[model samples]
Structures are given as C-alpha cells and as structure tokens.
Target: MGQGLSCAASQDHRFFSAVHFGDLETVNAMLERDPSLLYQTTYDRQYPLHIAAANGQIEILSMLLERSVDPDMVNRQKQTPLMLAAMHGKISCVKKLVEAGANMLKFDSLNGRTCLHFAAYYGHSDCLQAILSAVQSSPVAVSWGYSRFVNIRDGRGATPLHLAARQRRPECVHILLDNGALVCSSTGGYGSPGTTPLHLAARGGSLDCIRELLAWGADRMQRDASGRIPYVVALKYRNGTCAALLNPSSAEPLVWPSPLKFISELNQEAKALLECALMEANREREKNILKGTGYSLPSPSHSDDGTDDNISEASDTELCCICFEQVCTIEVEDCGHQMCAHCTLALCCHNKPNPTTACLTPPVCPFCRSTIARLVVAKMKDCNDADQDIGDGGSPKLRKSRRSLNFSEGSSSFKGLSATFGKMGGRGSGRIAAENEWVDKP
Candidate 1:
C-alpha cells in the first residue's frame, strides 16, 4: 500500500526539493504541469506546506497557500507547519502561517507543545511574540482566555516561561512575562516537578534570565518538589553569581515598578532609561554581595544606546540635585521635580512588591508629599549664561550662574543620599544661598 504512493509521488521528491531549496521557478512550472503536486504528500504524508515553512521559503510558501494549501497541515507526529517554523526560528514563516490562519493551539504529539512552546523552548522570541500577538485577538483567546493560553502547559507541564528560563532565553522570558505568563507558577513535570521558573533559571545559570524573572516578581523562596529552594539549586549548579543574588542574606533585588501607574505606563524611552538605571544600580549592589567571593560581574545582557543617559556628557545641567553625580533627566509629572533616572528608580524600587499581595502603596515625591503621578524625560535646559558676551561694546555682561559640580572631592560614600535628602529638595532660599555666595567668592 505505501509502496504505491512512494512510487507514484517519487515526483514528490522533486516537488519537496524545489520547495526546500527555494526554486520558485521550477516549482511554478511543476505546479503548472501537474497541479496535483501542490496538494500531494510525501512518503511520510508530510505536506509541501511543512517543507516550505521549515525551510523559510516564503515565496514558495505564499504560493502554496495561495493555491489552497492549508497552513495548519501536519505530518505523522502531528507537528504543523507553524510549529515547524517556530521550532526553526523562522520568524517570517511563522508570521506567514499565522496570517494564513494556522491554529495556534495545535499541539504536536511528540511533546504536546504548541507553537508558542516551540518558539520559547527553541529561543525564538520573535516567533514567540508573533504567536502571542495573534492569540490576543484570536477567538481561541476568548474561549480559553488570553492569560491562560499564555501560561499553557506542554506534556511535561512546563509553561513557556519555564522553558525560556531553562533554555537561558532571557528575552523570551521577558516577553512571556509581559504578555501575562505567571512569573511564579510551579511546574508539574519539568525539571523538579514542583520547580518554579526561578528554580529553572538558577539551574541554567543565566543571570540575565534571573534578572528578568525576579523583576517580574519571581519568588526565589519557592521550593521544588524535593523541598530545595532556588538558592540551593543555584549552589548545586555551581552558579556563584546566581547564588549570590539568590542568597537570602544579600540585598533585595530591584523590581519593576508596576504599581505606580505613571512609572508603569511610561513610554519606551522612559522604560529603557529606568531599566538601565535599575540594572546598573543592581550591579553596584552586587559588588557588595560578591565582596569575598571569586565570582565577578558578567557583561551587560542587552544593548543600550544611551540616548538619554548623559551622566558623562559635558552638559551644564548634568549633575542631579538628588544624587549630585548623575544627570537629572527625569521629571515627576505634577510635582515638576526632577532627579537622575537612577535615583528615581531607587525610590520606586526601595519598596519591593510581595508576589502574593493584592494591592500596593504608590511611592510619593521626596520633594513634595504629592502622590508621584508620572515621569517624563526632562527637556535639556541651558543652565549656563549662553548670552554672557551678548553686550554690545561692554554694555554690561550678564551674570554667570554658580557652577554645579559632581558633589565635591573627598566626599563621603553617600553624598546627597545622606540626611540632607529632602531638605535640599528645593533650591535653598536664605542660608544655603548665602553659603553659596560666600563659597563662590573670587
């Protein structure tokens, strides 16, 4: 019975070859000569759709779909073309299949994993996000619910977040968390059965993944089925840097500010600014945690173009009043007070959210007691006497503003962060002004 199909569609060998190698010309001629080739399956009943999709032959793929090829067509193992595209990290093919109305919830028999699972487990974040974006508006989301589908499990009861963490895919972990995957959900079969995403991240020894998971509220204290916490798992895997962060004795991790509607809803630029500030501050804190240990900090995990970070830039308004060493580029909305992005982050991250808490108190402005509403990239102001030499024939030159410095040389470890935090929130009026004048005397 099988010998006949194999003998007849030995022609399938040619058709698959053309689709796989992206020979659109040959494929078109073959289709014109034998229209049945477009719909024929190979010896294993693999559709032409799977070959074109897996090989990333977008031109041939689009042609197949145009000629009534099913995007969701599967082979013996029940693996669809969309799943194959995601498995191979073929983002364009994934998008094409998605646009052609492939079923996102279809699970392959080998692993009981959907396209999302394949994308995450294989570290294809772009493909993962594409599937998630489609699920948001698809009828499947309404029926199964969006968040539920995002946290959907595979045969081993591993969520996409768990797979991303175990595979050291930090960006995929971040994407899953952003799309409502539960950060602290425990696995049923993956890794230690009861292992959480944090546990898997610790075992994988990816500090970047740990940062992403912890910032999204992953519980480090959560235990696996064998009663071992993430810290123990980190130490078990010999991940000293990860162990240091997971250590209960170390300083608290900086969490993403999700309570402050203003901070949480900031635009992409502001968000990136806050993220860099958070990671840098955490890096500095990690130094203390690794004081006597042999482990050192790793290279930064993501690219930072530093469009708004100007601490080292030669701007007159570089020093922030709060930190006195960083550029004051972020502004509080209604209060109109400004501070360095780092210190601004410090205030928000000072209070870490409890993963089990239902509500949280939003942080207040240090300068004023007003509820901190929003943060914006403060516009650069010319804090210098730009018109100092504008006088025509010495018609009285303008006065120069007192030069601001990165605090003073030989200052204490904590400068503006000391007891003088809020008293200097505003420009000092009488006493401090007189002191400034006395100190600036030539």
Candidate 2:
C-alpha cells in the first residue's frame, strides 16, 4: 500500500508540473493513461486547472477544461482558477476562464474576495475590466445584478474600489468609478474600519487615486471609524503632498459633471476632451497647494524638454478667447458659441461633483449665457473673418450686448478670470501626479 501511494504521488507531481510549465503533450499523455489524475489534488486542494491558470498556461488549461475538469473548482483557500489568474495579472488566462464560465462571484477562503477583488487588489486593470465585462453578459448580472456585484463586499467589507485605492491602482480606481461603484462606501476591516476609498488612498499616499475619488464626489470631511478624515490620515502617514490635496481648507476639487445626461452621452473623442479638461482644472488647484514650498511643477507641456504634443499654432479665429493659448475646438449647439476645449471643460466640471443630477442644472454658454445644452467639434474660420472677431489679445473685437467672458477687455489672456479659475492658465492641459512626488516616506 505504501509503495502504491508513493507511485501515485510521483505521478501527480509530474502531471502538475507538466501543467504548470505548459507541457501540454506530457499532461495529455498522463491524463490519457490515467484519467483519474483529473480528480486528484495536492494537499492544498489545488488541481491541474489551478496550476495552469495561475501560471498562464492557456493551452494546458483549455485541455484540462475540455477533458471535464471543473472550471470553478477551489483550493483549500477557496480561490478558484479564475481568481488566481486575475491576481497574477494573467489577462489571457482571465479571459479564458471567463469564457469557460468560471464563477466570478466566488469568494476565496481567506478574504471573502471575488476575482474582481483580486484583480483590483493586485492592480491588474485589464483583468478587472475583463471580469466586469463578463458580468454584463453572464448570469451574474441577472441573479446578483451588475451594480451590486460591482460594490460587493469582502469579508472585511472592502469593495473592489477600496482595494484598488489602497493599492494605488489609479486606472482601476477610474474604471470602478466609471462602472458605478459607490465612491464613498466604507470598509468594515478592523485595520481601517469605516474607511472610505478616499481614506485608503490618502493612507497609501496615491494622488491619482485621491484625484479620481474626489472627482467622483468622495467627501473629504467624512470621518472613518476612528473619527479620522482622509486629510488627518494623510498627515499621520507623513504624506505631505497628498495632505495638501486632502486639506479641507483648500478649494474643492472639480467634480465629474455626472449631472448632465448629455455629458455622459458625448462621443468618445469629445468626452475624452472634456475629461482631460476636468483633470487639468484639478491639477491647477494642486499646483497652488505645492507652491511656496520645496516642490516645483513641471511646465505645461509636462515634458522636461518643454514641448506639448496637444498644442499647435492656430489662426487668430481659432484662438480660445478665454486662454488665448489654444484653439477653440469645442462648440455649443443652438447658441453657436465656441471656446477652447480647456475652457469648455473648466466651465462644465468646475462644480463639485454631485451624486445625483436631478436637482442640478447644465452650465450655460459664457457668450450668450443661454443654457449650454450641447457641445460639438467647432469649425475653423478664415483668418480675415477671425481678425474681425479679435485684435491684439484674445478679447473679442466685436462685443455681444451681454457680458463678454467677463474679461476686462485688455487682459490678453485667461488671467482675467481669477474669480472663476483662481488664476489657472495651464498651456490648456494634463495632470500633476505624473511626478509620483506624493509617495510616503519609508
């Protein structure tokens, strides 16, 4: 009996190793000779499918699944192959498992974390997106509902958003927010009980995550279980850079204009234009906070070499009357008024993000002050006609009866809108967190 057991153990090790290294031929040969090897598992309860998926051995994984191996099988830790694939950032493996009908909602034995949690915690944005895409077309959407699954709590009551923020995965944070994850939901973990994603981001000192959270309407004044707000948490962790943004005394960061239905339905290119504008405005606020200190922001181009890929010399008619720096690329419908994309974004996203848009109103055109219902790409005009609209500065040569972008008529630039922008005229674009200067000290 002992001899038989030893032989079985050796064979199992060989088969598992074959699967792990993607030696599909050896695995197929072993499985063909002894089909029962498919039923065997290591002491940790891990199977050949788990090994193949975890190691990104897609061919071997597909073979095992084709041979009747259960896709949702869990090991001792209750982690399915799908969870392992996502945790390891194996995007191909994740997609394979999803298509194979692996259960995305299954939680691991250790943390009650689903594959979504694993993807977010491990900073695998692609994997996270894959799992989310699966949920939309799968039964998980029907039974558990898409929104509930997105904000599903782990054993510690932390959602995927919380994990992504705590891990400093900014792209994951943006995705979660885009998909309707509750921005202000609190975690139930003892280590950071009642902690919001904002608090975790501050603790981790990730400015990008913090910026996304604030843009989604995360409350800076909300306290955690210990009565500590994100600002206090940032200061405690000695994240001076993060603390500056989290400081409640500073100006409120601009929120995503979720209040406008048209804003959400904009074409991808136009929407991207506005989104860049939103981030640009908040970056300007961050620049103010870092000034008079040891820190120095890079020039507007964001390149140390000081060149902007987004900017191009434009004719006078194409110039943005507000900034005089960039072209008037976006237009308001009905009103037929236009501004540079930056000023358009600055106007729409300037309001702090409200959780709901029902009680809110759309922004009006700076020119006609009419309800600015729609925005589209603007048409460029002839230089001769442009000369008639403006002369030396960005100020309009022909003034409408209503107040002009409220400029003093001679300022030549956006500097005149200090009351609205707080003196932001950033070559009209990008964010400030690219420097990674917000990192916490060791």
Candidate 3:
C-alpha cells in the first residue's frame, strides 16, 4: 500500500510540474508513456487539467482534454477545470473546455458558485463573455433548455450580476445584462438581504456600474436587510458621484422637456392646482370645526417643550431653519444644529431640502457649514413628562427618524410621476437630457 501511494504521489508531482511550467513537450511525452497519469491528482486534489487551466497553459489543457480527461472533474473545492480557467481569465482555455463538453451549470460544492460567478467576481469580462456565449450556444443548453444559467444564484443568493456589480466590472455587468441577467435580482444572506446589483454598484462606488445598472432598469429604491437603498449606500460609502446620480431631484433635470410635452404638462399643473385647493379647503373646514368646539390647535412649542423652557428660549430656536415654521425636532449628527423632522428627512433621507430642487452634493450642515454625516431625530418630552436633563455631555436619546420609512413607497410615487410625465410627450426628450447631464457633470 505504501509503495503504491508513493508511486502515485511521484506521478502527480511530475504531471502538475509540467503543466505549471507550461512544458507542453514534456507533458506530451509523459502522457504517451503512462496515459493513466492524466487522472493523477496533486496533494490538494488538483488534477493536471486544473493546473494547466489555472496557469493559462492553453495548449496543455487542450491536450489533456483531447486525451479524454474529465473536464468536469472536481478538486477538493469541487471546482472544475472550466471554473479554474474562467476565474483566471484564460479565455482560450475556457473556450476549449466548453467546446469539450464542460458543464457551465456545474457549481463548486463549497459555495454553490458557477463558472460565471467566479469570472464576474474576479472581474474577468472576456472570460465571462466567453462562458456566456458557450452556454448560449451549447447543444445541451438548447435541448435541455438551460439558458437561465446566466442568472443562477450561488449559496449566498448572489447572481453573476451581483458579483460583477460588486467587483465594479462594468463590461461584465453589461455582458450579463445583455445575456438576460436579472437587473433587480438581490443577494440572500443574514448580512444583506434584498441587496440588488444596484446596491452593490453603489457600495463599490463605481459610476460606470451605476450608469449601466440604471440604464438596464435596476431598481435604485430596493432596500437591503439594513433598510438602506442604493443612494443611501453610496452616501454611507462616501460615493458622492453615485449618490448624486441616484438622487431623485437631480435625476429629473437630466431629461429635457419637449415643447409639446411642456404644453401638455400645463394640464397636469392645472389638475395639481385643483387638488391643492381642495386639500386646503378640507383643512380649513377642520380648523373651523375645532374653533367652533372651543378647542385650538396646539402650538409647535407645546408639543416639544420639556420641563426646561430655557432650551426653547435660545435664539433662533422657535422655528426650524429649513422650513421656518415647524418646531425643530431633528438634529444634524456631530453638528447638533436643529431642524424640523420633515426638513431633516428631506435633506438627509431624500438628499434635497425640497422635492423639486436637485439634491445637494456632499450634504453640509445648513448652519455650521460642516459636513452632515448623518441626521437623528431629537427626543422631546411633552409638558406633562418628568423633568430630564438635556445636556451635551451625554448621548442624546434619538427618536426613530425617516430612514425607517418604506423606500418602496417613495419610489412608487416616482413611478407615478414618470407615468404622468411620460404621457405629456416629454419622456424620450427628458431621458436624453438626463443622460447627457449625467455624462457632463464633473
């Protein structure tokens, strides 16, 4: 038994060495002497085929395959030779392996990841394209109807699109999208549920990825397990260009309005004006009813005032700086400048002070002019609550802010806006304008 094992080990070492050093002549000579050495594996379970493919020894790989080496033979990691070639960007080797009937859908046992996933993860655009072409052209794929391999998810529920986006491979992203990879497909796992390719692109800070994803109809509003959208992820990672592109307000101006559409939009404005009037009238009627019942609406101060009146007495404390109406209920993190919750939500959560204007790039504290890292709701006590010290010494108990609001709900409104705007004949023109503006910005 020991002698047999030693002989096997010696043969494995020789085969692997020849493949690794790209000694095609030596490999051919060895194979001719002992054809069974083709099946010998290294200590790591890597066969001669795996080594040659990994090292881009295309000639050696072709020879091994021609000798009837198992193209789908898995090593210790359950990775086939095709996967090895695709991962290392050995495009010729990948083509040869696929042509020899290597399985494209075969996944590594460790991660349930396919060759395309490895190619995308490693940013091998050419290899990815080759694999995609192979799968699409395969006789088995056509007969067995397995074209969905392009969008196959791995153990982490991440598709090749997700991996490509995460790796910031714009060319890979484009290839996958063109090949029917789902743009809105998300990752699955405890770490980041519902994290779509767009979210990955935003986190990677790749402007090209962002553009490709958005162009391919990636859902920007899709939230992860942490309740973060692509825009929020961009901001979290300090990807200002991506955040700006994802900003809803800035996105509108990119699409130029057509003259005919502009004329048609006047009808929508008239309808909106009518709706506003009706809403105001309803509110006035409610106020009148309250007045008739001898009850008055409480002032903003009454809702937020704690035991200490001095905090409210501070200069510029009566009204929020952003809205200049409602009591300040939110504070800029690190700066402690107070503003109304609505204004804070508009600025921090939506990236704009008002819904109509473009979002601010590199958001800053309106008062201190300091960079606004985040926004938190200030916990306020009602007049009936017990006395509590409100000081700068301790961390403030923050109230849940607008970040928790359902992002889907906000995006639904945009969809409605788009539909409404599209009917006005400006859809095509607006999109062209937006695309141009996005490309021109510094």
Segments in model 2 whose C-alpha atoms lie over 4 Å from true places: 188-193, 295-314, 333-337, 350-358, 367-424, 428-442
Query: Which digits, one per residue and each the tens of the lDDT, describe model 1 over residues 84-191?
Result: 999999999999888889999899999899999989999998999899999888998999999899999998788999999999999999889877888888876534
lDDT against the true structure, each candidate? 0.74, 0.77, 0.63
Question: Per-residue lDDT for 345-368 in model 2, tens only?
Answer: 767665343458435567766655
Give lDDT tens digits, candidate 3, residues 153-178.
89989999999999999889977876
- Best first by lDDT, ranked: 2, 1, 3
Task: Mark the 10 consecutive residues where model 3 has the least summed lDDT.
Answer: 254-263
Clashing pairs in 1: 9-12
* TM-score winner: 2
Q: What TM-scores do the predictions have?
A: 0.80, 0.82, 0.56
27 Cα displacement, candidate 2 (Å)? 1.0
Model 1, runs deviating above 4 Å: 1-7, 189-193, 300-318, 351-358, 384-442
Better of 2 and 3 by lDDT: 2
Error of 3 at 25 (Å): 1.8
Model 3 lDDT on a 0 to 1 scale? 0.63
